[model samples]
Target chain A: TQLLEQSPQFLSIQEGENLTVYCNSSSVFSSLQWYRQEPGEGPVLLVTVVTGGEVKKLKRLTFQFGDARKDSSLHITAAQPGDTGLYLCAGAGSSYKLIFGSGTRLLVRP
Target chain B: SQTIHQWPATLVQPVGSPLSLECTVEGTSNPNLYWYRQAAGRGLQLLFYSVGIGQISSEVPQNLSASRPQDRQFILSSKKLLLSDSGFYLCASDPGGEKLFFGSGTQLSVL
Candidate 1:
């Protein structure tokens, strides 16, 4: 199994603060996807990084794929109250299955 | 545009009861389908997937089983339900690319 471990399982920060959530794995992945999930709802895809060392920006959110494709990161700058939710990173293995990280719950206080 | 639909947004059933959850995709053909279960405070666990009709692949060997009788429909069923089966069930599809489009999801509660 391609295990993706995300750090800081939970995070609480005041509005305008910056934070980074890390997803690491020992096995290389062909692609990695980041998602944000709200309570009582399915996850919504945020970004997909296919190439190594690729960085994509979605508004205030920045996502980076590791050079080795074994890790990824999600950074939120000047976070707002609307940013609170559960963030998950999924790595695609050789098969069709996606190995999901444990997830990180973040709360941005306004 | 394409859309995925999962039936019975919320279900409450007793233990040892039969279970059936249906998912269908519209405006697309021959897409990869996936069934995932999400426990509270955790990530998604892939239960089953299908590349085409009657081509189900079980990611985990357990009580739950999935079937794809048609090209655009996937069904998850079990003869007897377990308390551990209570969780959120999600269905997704990806025609191409690594990204998947998800359905609204089904919340099943086994008592």
Candidate 2:
């Protein structure tokens, strides 16, 4: 069974602070995706990194896929209260399955 | 617009009771469907997936069973429920970009 490890299972920071969440895996994935889930709601897609060493940005959020495609990270710049939620990293395999990371619960207090 | 719908926003059931949750996709056909379970304040876990009609695949073996009776309809069922089964259930559809569009989700409480 493949596993994805996320750093800092829980995080709390004040507004205007920057935070980064990491997802590392031993197995290589075809692509990696980042999602943010709020309480009582399902996860919503944030971004997807397909190529190794690829970097994608969404406004204040940045995503990177490792050169070996076995790891990824999400960095939030100048975080705000609205950015607080569970950040999840998911990897897709060749067999059409998505392996999800345990998730990082982030709280940005104003 | 493409959308996914899951029923029973919230449920309360006693242990040993039967379980049934439904998920359906609209405005899209022949897409991949998936079922996930989220423990209280945790990430999503892939439980089942369907690529086509009658083709259901399970990722983790547990007390749950999934079926795809139609192209856009998926159902999660269990003959018996356990307290451990209490969680938030989500349904998602893939539109070929490796991104899964998720439904609003269902919160089940097995007392």
Candidate 3:
């Protein structure tokens, strides 16, 4: 079974602070995706990285895929209260099934 | 672009009662559909997936069952509900490549 482990399961920071969340796995994936979920709602796709060592930016968020495709990271620059939500990383392997990480809950106090 | 629609935003049922959750997709045809269960503020556990009509794949063995009655419709059912079955159920669709589009989710409470 493939599993994705996320670091810093919970984070609380002041507005304007920078934070990074990490997702790691031993198995390689064909693609990785980042999602942000608000309470009582479904997760929204943030970005998808298909190539190794790839970096994509969306507004204040930067997503990076590891060189081996076994890990990914999300960095938030100057996070705001609006950025507080549960962040999840999902990896798609040969089976086309997405294996999701445990998720990191961010609380940005204004 | 694909959109997933799930019904009954919240459900409260007894342990021995039956269950049925419906999901439909729009803006795409013959899309890959999936059913996932999530704990409170946690990750997603894939329960079933269907690649085409009348095709279903189960990732785990439990009291739940899934079916695809139409090209864009997926249904999850159970003869009896369990306390462990209480969770947030989400319906998702894959528009070919692997990126998923998810529904608002249904919170099932089996009391």
> Among these predicted structures, which one has the highest lDDT?
3
Runs in model 1 deviating more than 4 A are none
Off by over 4 Å in 2: none
Tens-place lDDT per residue, model 3, A1-110, is 99999988999999999999999999999999999999888999899999999999999999999999999999999999999999999999988589999999999999
Tens digits of per-residue lDDT for model 2, A29-107: 9999999999888899899899999999999999999999999999999999999999999998887778899999999
Candidate 1 matches the true fold with a TM-score of 0.97
Model 2 achieves a DockQ score of: 0.78
TM-score of chain B of 2: 0.96
DockQ of 3: 0.83
lDDT of 3: 0.95
Q: Quote the lDDT for B57 in model 2.
A: 93
TM-score to true structure, per model: 0.97, 0.97, 0.98
Task: Compute the interface RMSD for candidate 3.
Answer: 0.7
Runs of candidate 3 exceeding 4 Å displacement:
none
The lDDT of each candidate is 0.93, 0.92, 0.95
lDDT of 1 by residue, A3-110 (tens): 889988999999999999999999999999999999877788999999999999999999999999999999999999999999999999788778889999999998
Per-residue alpha-carbon lDDT of candidate 2 for residues B7-99, written as tens digits (9 for 90 to 100): 988999999999999999998888899999998777789999999999999888899999999999999999999999999999999967568
